[model samples]
Target: MIYAGLDVGSRTIKLVIFDTVVKESLITETGANPLRRCREILAGRKLRRLVVTGYGRHLVASTQGGKVVSEIRAFAVGARYLLPDCQGVIDIGGQDCKVVRLSMEGDVLKFEMNDRCAAGTGKFLEVMAHTLEADIGAIGDLALTASRKITINSLCTVFAESEVVSLIGRGEETAAIALALHEAIATRVATMARRVGIKGKAVFAGGASLNRCLVRLLGEKLGIELTVPDSPQLVGALGAALLAKHEDGQ
Candidate 1:
């Protein structure tokens, strides 16, 4: 039997199909309108069960009879399934960030989330990069070449952009400013993770994990080694699919 999971996030949508008997998986992404895209992706495919998760999950119609899972719970399950030794998860999406601490069995121990602001999320980096006239995709590599840390004092995205512009006016190297941005984001996320008390092996998920500079800075700030899954952004969908199979069993 095949189980399907859909994670409809703010910036992107992800889908994962898991085969029960063979334990194989297929993962894909659809930029927006997740519900419609999911339907189109699953056309003619026989799925034994389906689950939905993420911030935009409620937008998915209940008429489809798919089970709805919280993004936090789904991430916990996905992290556990992929990295059985994982004890915590740090997921930084486009607009929000979450730090989840789990027991050895993958049960939630504690968690903290920063959804009210974009300071610690991917959007902040995107905006900063745009302000610096730098490519978002190249920020990581550019930051690595910096010789000094340029401080970004503002946690507010608007104020931070203005700060970056001011730094540019001062003839600061973009690399230094980029390093500062990543460090700022790392500091914000690390502070949240400390509230829940990071434990054991940690797994970093979501699109931001793809940023090497952010990952290194975050790990350094948290004082813990972090692991990234093959496809960090798909972890939620994978968990949803796993939940679909578990639900089918009951």
Candidate 2:
């Protein structure tokens, strides 16, 4: 029987099905009607066990029926499974960022999360890309071409946008501005990782993990190698699926 895990997040929904190995996995934008998106994804599938996680986990659990797991637990478990020797996990999602420190046994030791604002998150990157009038999907790659980027001090979304505009008016290179924005995020995330006392290699998960610029900058700033799964956004869902399989087996 296939066990399923669903991570219904603010910006995207991830689904994972496991039968000895991961047999099915998908990631889609949450869109305006996230519940509908979730329902559509789960349709016509027979799942023996289901576990829900992410920002909208409870919403999915109450309406769709599944075991609920916290984002912290899901990331820890998922990172541990993907990188068995991993000591921590960092997830930079659409609206928030999470840092998890793990024990050798894959238990959560300490974790930090920034969900109070859009600053230093995927939302920030999206907005910055829009402000630069650059393709959101290509912004990361474009940033990689820049020789250097200017300093951005504000973490607030509105303030940062204003800063970008001022930089543009001053004839700052578009690529440089984009690179600076990603640098800001890297600085913030690296600071969080250090504050959490993370050691050894860590798994980088969530949609933002797709941004190569952010990944490289973060890894450099932290002075540690970051391991990314083939499908980083599905890590939470994979964790939930593993949990579902464990529960069903029991």
Candidate-wise lDDT, in order:
0.87, 0.91
Per-residue C-alpha lDDT of model 1 across residues 86-145, encoded as one tens digit per residue: 999999999899999999888999999888999999999999989988899889989999
Give the TM-score of each candidate.
Answer: 0.94, 0.97
Please give, for residues 52-145, the per-residue lDDT of candidate 2 as tens digits. Answer: 9999998889888899999999888888889999999999999999999999889899999999989879999999999999988899999999
Question: Which is the leading candidate under TM-score?
Answer: 2
Worst 10 residues of 2 by lDDT: 147-156
Alpha-carbon lDDT of model 2 = 0.91
Residue 156 deviation, candidate 2, in Å?
Answer: 1.0
Query: Model 1 reaches what TM-score against the true structure?
Result: 0.94
Which pairs of residues collide in candidate 1?
none
